[model samples]
Target: MTDISPILEFLPCPTPEAWIEEARKPENLAVILVDHANNELKAAQSAMAIMSRYRTGKFGQNRGTSHSNEEKVGLQLKTDDQLSLLNKMSRLAREELRHYEQVLAIMARRDIPYVHLGAGRYAGQLSTAIRTFEPFRLVDTLIMGAFIEARSCERFAALSPWLDDELKKFYLSLLKSESRHFQDYLTLAEAINGASVADRVAIFAGIEQDAIESRDHHFCFHSGVPA
Candidate 1:
């Protein structure tokens, strides 16, 4: 695997030390593991949704309108770029799902019950900044994806040293794919925009940093500093 030190420098924000210290507490391990499993599934779902919406062009059509049926039937891979995007997203979705399964297996071995829990406000708060327009919205979304994956990678690296042997190995193993996921999202965003995404990236970087550094009422895999 490639050295993560260089990749960490590319991230817009670093994982907060306060959050890492809170996460290292043994009492929070179960909740963190469970939430990490859910996060993997959610990440896969989000990527799949992007493929469906953009590559297939099926997302924006009004369901109650007369054109809804036509839109649904019109889903087809149109361009080389779309095809490429579809392929990348499909692979990412599969990998993320596999990670979800891996997390579940670890949870089972540790006898940590998988229970449904509400997600933290980190994602929701970042999503609020997404533009409501077409290509711009897509660009913003992809940049947000990059930030999310980058942060996940950062957190995994930060927490790995503090975890038990099994988890430390697992998190270290995940670093490569998580790093690639961040790169893929950024690449797609730049390709789709046909321009540098640096400004938008900077905008979301501030948002992501605030979400990570601020105090939170609950602790989860991606939550900020513990309250």
Candidate 2:
């Protein structure tokens, strides 16, 4: 496996040590694994949502336009950048879905029944900060995606060594794709915004950090300090 040290540097916020310590407990393993599977599915759905909303600009246009004609016209009107974003999000969505399946297979082997848990407050807290404007809203969304992916990668790295052999191998195998996903989101955000997203990225970084460090009543894959 490739060294993850360099890639870890790119993350705006690191997973807190307290959270990782909690995650590494044997009693928490089953819940952590189940939540992780759910997270993968959610990530795939988020990517698909972004692609659908921005791909052909159909979602952005006037409500009077017929759906069929809007799709046709939107395709014709799509800019090269929009096409690129669509392609990247498509690939990302597929990868996340595949990861979701892999996690489920692992769960099956371990006899851990899949359970749907309420989502942690981490993402919802970040969503509150998203700008309501058209392209800025999109930019904030992409930046949020970047933060989520980066934090996942960080948590994976932090938790891997403490896991059992099978889990260690699986988590290590995921680092590369998670790393790429963060970069893809960041790159697309900057490209779509036509300017450096450094300031905006920093802003989201602080928000994400707050979410990570805050006291959370529930424990899930992306949760903050365990209550």
Candidate 3:
């Protein structure tokens, strides 16, 4: 197993008593709606990335490695490099889909309509600022995944006190998995490059920290302080 102890230390869980009190509040159903929808969208995107890059031939002729509920819409990749990249992306997509389902279950029980929050600066910046080199892009993507998962863990822990019992339990359960996901991404980056990713990690860490600290006009799973 990947050693994610360091990231675990960063979790900000609250006391149980406080968590239950917050979870029972009816207003939180809205937050749950947005949270679950965001998970669903992220999962769908990941799966789409995999399908477009890894699937072969016609859809009926060839099947994909990923077996997610999300359909493999199309295979648009032009090279083996893309297939390999999508294979890795498949792993991420699976986990994200699981997260989506988990949140959806909660929302269904609460009778809330799922509504996704907009992309935070973290993911948006990656789309706009990522390097063109494949190797560099891989490293950057891994680092970005790590940061996103870590931030999610941090927020889950932070928001626990304000959540209800079931929700709090779900969030607490997420901490370990999210921490491991962060480590997995970092490890893959190092394994692929066979070079030190420290400088890259530091560079992105600085950006991630800034993103988390800055005031934001909107709030999402990875958004910074609300404006």
Candidate 4:
């Protein structure tokens, strides 16, 4: 198993035992599997959304537009940065979709048909709280991505011991990659912000802790303590 101490340390609160127990119930199995698959898809979508922010042409001047030497240099630098971010998000998105495919395969073997589920409050709360300004917006989004990935990894680790052999192995495998994805997001956020994110991290940590510890009737991969 991957050493996920870093992921655990990054998270403000551990997933509640009550949630795990409720998740383990046979009655919830189908919902769990289906929701989990949905989460993977959502993860992929989030990565793409980040990539959307870095679209290449957006970094350059409009067609037939003139630029001073300094502006030209700035455009080149921004384009390079955009390309780098675009590459990272592309890989992250692809990996998430692969995980989605794996989950769907497992669900199929178990005869659990995919079903629609609503978003839980956890993501909406964090997203709505993000600062709606340049740089800060992207920074908060990346930070949010890191926390979500870290929590997912932690949850997988927490649930592994109780799962069947196939799921146990699959969840364990995800921790290594997903935890790395967590780190990737943090590194990118700090790089893009060009400053220490300690303050923002602390604030978001509190929000995440509240989201995790609050009583939530919603049952999903990222839900808080089961109500």
TM-scores, all candidates, are 0.88, 0.88, 0.70, 0.89
- lDDT digits (tens) for residues 1-227 of candidate 1: 44677558766567778888888998889989999998999999999988878866433633344543234434333366577778888999999999999999999999999988887998998898897655566778988888888888888988898999999999999999999989988988787666788888888878887888888998888888788
What are the runs in model 3 whose C-alpha is more than 4 Å off? 1-5, 8-29, 47-89, 126-129
Q: Candidate 3, residues 1-227: lDDT per residue as tens digits?
A: 33445775533321233333443356655764576468556745854653563355222323334432113323332355455556656776777778888887787897777664556675775444344444455457667676667766665676666677887788788777777666766776675545667877776766666666666665455555556
Tell me the lDDT of model 1 at 180. 90
- Residues 71-107 of candidate 4 have per-residue lDDT tens digits of 4334332555566678888999999999999999999
- Which ten residues in a row are the worst by lDDT in model 1? 68-77
Off by over 4 Å in 4: 57-80
Candidate 1: C-alpha lDDT: 0.82
Q: Against the hidden true structure, what lDDT does model 3 obtain?
A: 0.59
RMSD of each: 4.9, 5.0, 9.5, 4.7
Best by lDDT: 4
Candidate 4 backbone overlaps, count? 0
Q: Candidates 1 and 4: which is better by lDDT?
A: 4
* Candidate 3, position 11, lDDT: 30
Question: Model 4 TM-score?
Answer: 0.89
CA lDDT, candidate 3, residue 192: 50
Instruction: List pairs with backbone clashes in candidate 3.
Output: 23-163, 23-164
Q: What lDDT would candidate 2 get against the real structure? A: 0.82
